[model samples]
Structure formats: structure tokens, C-alpha cells
Target: MCHHTQPVTGVPLNSCTSREKTSILQLLTLGMNSHTLPTCRVHHMEGRADPGRVPAAGGRPEEGDEADAEGDGPWPEAGDPRGEVGDFLSLDLGGTNFRVMLVKVGEGDAGQWSVKTKHQMYSIPEDAMTGTAEMLFDYISECISDFLDKHQMKHKKLPLGFTFSFPVRHEDIDKGILLNWTKGFKASGAEGNNIVGLLRDAIKRRGDFEMDVVAMVNDTVATMISCYYEDRQCEVGMIVGTGCNACYMEEMQNVELVEGDEGRMCVNTEWGAFGDSGELDEFLLEYDRMVDESSVNPGQQLYEKLIGGKYMGELVRLVLLKLVDENLLFHGEASEQLRTRGAFETRFVSQVESDSGDRKQIHNILSTLGLRPSVTDCDIVRRACESVSTRAAHMCSAGLAGVINRMRESRSEDVMRITVGVDGSVYKLHPSFKERFHTSVRRLTPNCEITFIESEEGSGRGAALVSAVACKKACMLGQ
Candidate 1:
């Protein structure tokens, strides 16, 4: 229910100005103010579609029920069905390193439980990374077999959770169709295939260990569940690494894809795919266009390309190239390394931005990249890196603000106090990114008090926890 009009700036319609150069940030802030983002619109319409429907889950109080006068459900109500006591296996396979974990959950006093975990990490070879699906999964199965042997649990059939950090169209808790590969992954026969089925087939081929794969979840969902163990208030999971995505608990009534309108379900907002519909064309500059055109998956995951670590370096490189062309850097002479694609790595962005008010650090990085930079050149490059990184942090915050506000409104809370579980190298390793991201999110969500908990080994633990929950639910249903 909003309208748009082209502004008359006393110049040609297509003419660019400083205001236009700064409008992307302004547009982000304004869109968040009006809750007009694509994410916000979808969340608001879906979450508030039914204001009076009673949740089928017994925890929520029904309207006009005298016993529920408090207006809030008991936090982690007695005998909560989510608690599961068992030993579970978790496999995390999103990045170049794959992990296998054995988690043991045991009952304790006063509804608390003790969790013990053992995990091993394996590096994925280049051949295995870009090979056929069978090859990729066979390597995974072999790793699991080796882990089970080390743990002396090769004969025990344990429930397993697969944490696949990619875009997936899930049909059930255990079945997901791989939409596409991201993070430089180009494994053949994976796209448009059931990810779990491929894993099961690979395990059968190995025949060294038996596993009951119960559920499959994205890394964000796993992080949320894992953090929920430490603080029950955690309902959102986000990753800002090679790619970006988030998942949060949503009222079941609002999820059209799922049948039951009861309690809540975690909805994975594959937000990296947000701008694929051309929603961000106005914000994209020539640098962004060039990066997109040369990417493995051109014109796809547009939002992620702008914010993810994989493309941030290339964006900076393009900007530096333009600066060279304008005679503003390196005396209008571009180094061969500067002209190379991906030569300016993403880590250089962090290193340059970490400079302590002196040009020494920036000069070192530029020189290492084959650039003979003067003091002015070093300063210019540092500013360019800061600009790119700042915009990325703000844009990510805008997306999260939309989610937090929607959650608060869905429950009719005057002030919602919530915790978000976060993971990934970009969010964790960048010196200023965490602070910048937190400040922006707080500014955007005025009605919410948010706490961000950085997760430790959360992906694997979360996958195991999700499997445990699914197993407990199945037991209750006698399935």
C-alpha cells in the first residue's frame, strides 16, 4: 500500500548527484522505518494474517480463557516436549572443512541436562569439492566412518542431523531439495536433488556405520536451536560468512507451506536470494554489476554477493580499478596484480580497515599486492574499504531489523526482549563489523531489546539438537 515517485532534482532525470550516491543508505533506513522491505512485507502479512486464531499447541492461552489472564505463556513450560535425552550424531558440510560430531544429552536435576560432545574436522579436497554428488557424499560418508571408529560407536545406530548451508526447498523435516550451490561450490548432480537422499545412498555404499538420519536443517536453524539450549529466549539464527541467511521461529498459522497452524516453526528466510527479483537495481553500481557478471552464478544471490565475504574483495578491486582510471590512484598506473580478478582478497579489506590512524598498515597491504602506493593512495584505499564494509554491515542490519519488528508485532509485545544466535567468519573475525552491525540493528528495532550471542561450534551442536527434538516429537506421536 505504498507509492513511489521520481524526485525532481532540478537536473536531468538520469543525472547523478551526491544525494543519489548516498541514497542507498537513506533508502535502507527509510524502508526499515516504514517496514517496507520485501522481508518485512512478507513477514508482516504472514505473521499477522490471523489475530484471533488459537494456537493448537497447549502452551498458548486461548482467547477469553480465564486461566491465561497473565497474557504470556510460561517460558519453557513444565515437561516441555522439546527435551530429548540420547546420543546423536551431527554432520556439518557447508564450507571447505566438514565436521562430524558425537553429542550425548543426559538428564539432570530441575529440568536441566548435561551435553557432552566430541568432534573432528576434515578438509575437503578440491577434486571432492567440485566433483559429482556421489564423490562429494562418499568422502563425507568416509569421514563419518572414521569418526565412529575413533569414538568406538561403529555398531550403534544413532540419529543424525545434516546441516547443509545452502538454498533448499524443504518438503519435510528430513527431506530437502537442493536449490543451488553457493560459496564457490559447483558439485554436479547436487542441484535439484534431495540432499538427504544422496547422503543416505553414500552411507549405504560405505556400510561401515549405521545412522538414522532424522532431520536436516540449514546452518542458521541449527545455530538458533543450539543457542536456545543456553538461553531459551533465542529464536533467531543468522550467518554472515561466505553467504548470508537467517532463520527464525514463526507462528505456524502464518506459514502457508506447512499444514498445521499450531505453536511455531522455524522459517528459513533464504534472504541471499532477496534481490534476484530486481528489488535492488537502484542500489547496484557499476562495480557490483561487474562483480556479478564475472561470478560463477551471475545474476543470482545478488544480495549475498553484495554482503558476503566471497565477493567483498572483488567489489573493492573494481572500485580501485575505477579510481586508477580516474587518475586518482597510483599516478594513473594500475599494477598487474590490481588488474587481476580476486587478487585483492577479502582479508585485505579487514586488514586495511584495522589500520590504527596511520597509513603504515594500509601501505603494507597495498605493497604486498604489488602496488607502489604513496601516503595519499594508502588513505584513499583505506576509505574505499571502509565504505564497502560499512554499507554491507548496514544492509545486513536492515534485514534483521525487519525480522525483529515483525516478531514483536506478531505477539503484540510493547517491548520484546530476545536473543539472536550468530555465526560465520565475517561476523566473528571482522574487527569493526560486529560493533557496526549491532549498532545498526539496535537503531532499526526500537521496540525490541536484542542480545546477540556469538555461537561456539554451534553448527554441529545445533544439528544434533534439532535431530534430538525431531526424534522426541516422533516418539510422542508413536511413529
Candidate 2:
């Protein structure tokens, strides 16, 4: 939405007017306006649950119903990881790799549940990425069976925690109704189905996959739960990679569906699907528009397309293409390979930004497309990459700021020291990402103390912890 036109000065990196540069920075630093963010969108609908609503298992609400705090149903009891002691099976359906891990959590040195894992990795095949839901879940089931067979633990009905990351409305902790697919997933028969049922059926089809799914979790929620297991102070868990989303420990009283006696629970606020045709739509830059139009889902996940890792590299390419058109780089020569779709990726940005001595990696990446860049072009690429990624980091911090402030306002008494456990490649490996995230968070909410720590195995280990909780809750409910 930033209305900066082409520079009349010429195609030099520094030739752009101050207004043009500021527009890009504003898009990266704060988004269109603070109101166009998830913070305002969520605040307006915090407690708007419809009293006439009946909780349905794997239910889908009306169009605006997602805004209702409890319309998605009561937040399930997430079992305490602190006192959990046992060997639990965990399955992580990540974007790139599907993982099945046996996490051994038992009493350790400080009389706490220590986690150790017997891990197995299965590289999800290309066909499964865009294939049918059956193909995807069946493959995952096969991997589970393979892991059990390799470990010589078969025919055992072990507790399983399934971490399926997507938007889902869960009636209970162990089930989720798929809202829609993201992260370039276009598998048929995926949306509007229960992922737990799909995987369970897949497991049933595979006789060796005998474990019961005790809990179903989102990757981001698992990260928060994973961190909370280690440190009780961790109230938020997040994933900032191909896409960005956050989950936080919310007081149950505020959840309209829950009775006053129920304790606190974790809420998966699918904030990645944030932004719309209001101020946010009006604020879209030309590159952002291109990213969305070229994406699998157009006019959706506006925030994600602008800031998520999957689109960051594409953003760089879009900008580079613009420069090329303006005769800025490659002596105004446009490489046909650069115009090809999906040529540049987030990895290229990482390589360019992390370059210290020479931009060899950047050059090599571009070389694949048969283009040799000069020093000036390389510098321009690095700076643009940095700017795009910096914006992602800052936008992530802003969303977290909204979450922290919302929780703090409800409590209002203690100096709420919330800890956030973040996972994903962008936050974990990108240069200056950690510092940028921390700084932006501090800038937003200086009064409150927040610790943003990197967490791995959130989907794997966190699911195991949730399995422990689900089992305990099931037993208690029975009595």
C-alpha cells in the first residue's frame, strides 16, 4: 500500500529519494499502521463468544465466528510437563521433515522431568507435499511404523502426541478440524477434515502403528508447552520460519466457554492469517502484491506473505527484478532465469545476509540462472535481503508485543515475566534475527520483562508432554 513510485533520478542504489526508502522501512518496521495488525484485530473480539453456540467436536464456525474467544471451543487441559514421568511417543509433521521421536521424560537431577529422545527422521517425499491427504497421512503412518520396528518396540499401545501444524478448530486436545492448508500445501481432501482422524485411520491401516493419539497439538502451541515444561514462566510459544504464528497461556476465566472453576489453558491464536482490505490492504507494496498474486492462495495470509520465511526470498527477487527493469543492476540486463518462478528462495537471503568477506554464495545462487553480477549489484542484493528479513523480525516482535500486552492487561497485578519459546529456521539461523527480535520486543513493551528463547523439538517433545497431560485428564474426567 506504500504508494512510492519509481525514482526519476536513475537506477543507482542510493539514487532513490528519502520517501521511497522510508516507505520500505515503514512496511518492514511496523506494517501499514498498528491498527492493520493482528493486535487490534484480536483485541476487538476478545470475549465475543456466542452464548447460543453448542460446542461441536471438530466444528467450523461462521465467517466472523473465528473472532469469538471460545467459539473454537473450550481450551483443553494441557498436562503438566513438570511432573510428567514416562516414555511417550511423539510425532512431528513439520513442513520439510516428518519426525517420529520417543521422548524419555523422567525424574532427573533437580527432581524434574528430564527429556531424552530416541529420534527418527523421515524426509517427506515431494509427491506427498502436494498429493492427496491420504498419501500424506499414510506416509507419516509408515514412518511411524518404521520407527517402532527399528526400535524393536511393536504391538505396544503407547501414548502418542500428534503435532499437526495448520489452522484447526479442536473440540478437545486430541482432535482438530482442518481450517485450510498453508505453506504451499494443496493436498486434496485436506481442508474441512479431522487431521487426527486421518492420521489415526492411516495408522490403523498400518497394523504395526499401534499407538493411541492422546493429544493433538499445533506446532506453535507445542513450542509454548515445550518451554513451559522446562520453565513454568514460559507463557508463549512461537514459530517464525516459513510462516509466523504464536500461542500463549491464557487464563481460563477469560475463555467464555469454560466455567469459572477451570484453570488456565493454552490458546492457539492463528494470527498468521491476519490482515485484510482495510488499512492493511491499502498498505500493500507492489512486491507484496506480486508475492500474494503468485502464491497458492491469493488475498489470504497477508501478514504471512509479507513477513514469513517462505516469501522473504521471493520478496528479494521481486525487488531485484524491479531494479533490473529500472536499469539498476546487471547493466539493465534482465536475466530470463531471474524472471522464472521460484528461482530465488529464503536460503539465498540467508546466504547473502550472512556473507562477510565476499558474496560468493549469493553469486553462486544467481549463477545457477546464468547471470554474473558486479560488486554493486551484489551489495544491493545484500542490503535488500537484509531489509526484507529485518522487517519480518520486527513484524514478529510486534505480534508478540500484542499478545504479551493483552495477557498483562488481564492480570494487571504482578510484573508478568512471560517467556516465549520460538522455533523455526528464520529465528534460529538467520543473522541478526535474535538481536532484532529482542530489540523490537523491548521497544514495544519496555515495562514488562520478556525472554525470547530459541526452542527446538517443540513439535516432537512438546507433543510427548501433551500426551502425558491428555492421559491424566482422561482418567480424571472418567472419575
User: Which candidate wins on lDDT?
Assistant: 1
After superposition, the stretches of candidate 2 with alpha carbons farther than 4 Å from their true spots are 1-78, 81-84, 277-279, 475-479
TM-score of 1: 0.80
For model 1, what is the error of residue 106's alpha carbon versus the real structure, in angstroms, after optimal superposition?
2.8
TM match of model 2 to true structure: 0.83
- Score each candidate by Cα lDDT: 0.73, 0.69
Q: Candidate 2 residues 250-276, lDDT tens each?
A: 655665555553445566666666663
Clashes of each: 0, 4
Worst ten in a row by lDDT for model 2 = 57-66
User: Candidates' TM-scores?
Assistant: 0.80, 0.83
In terms of lDDT, model 1 sits at: 0.73
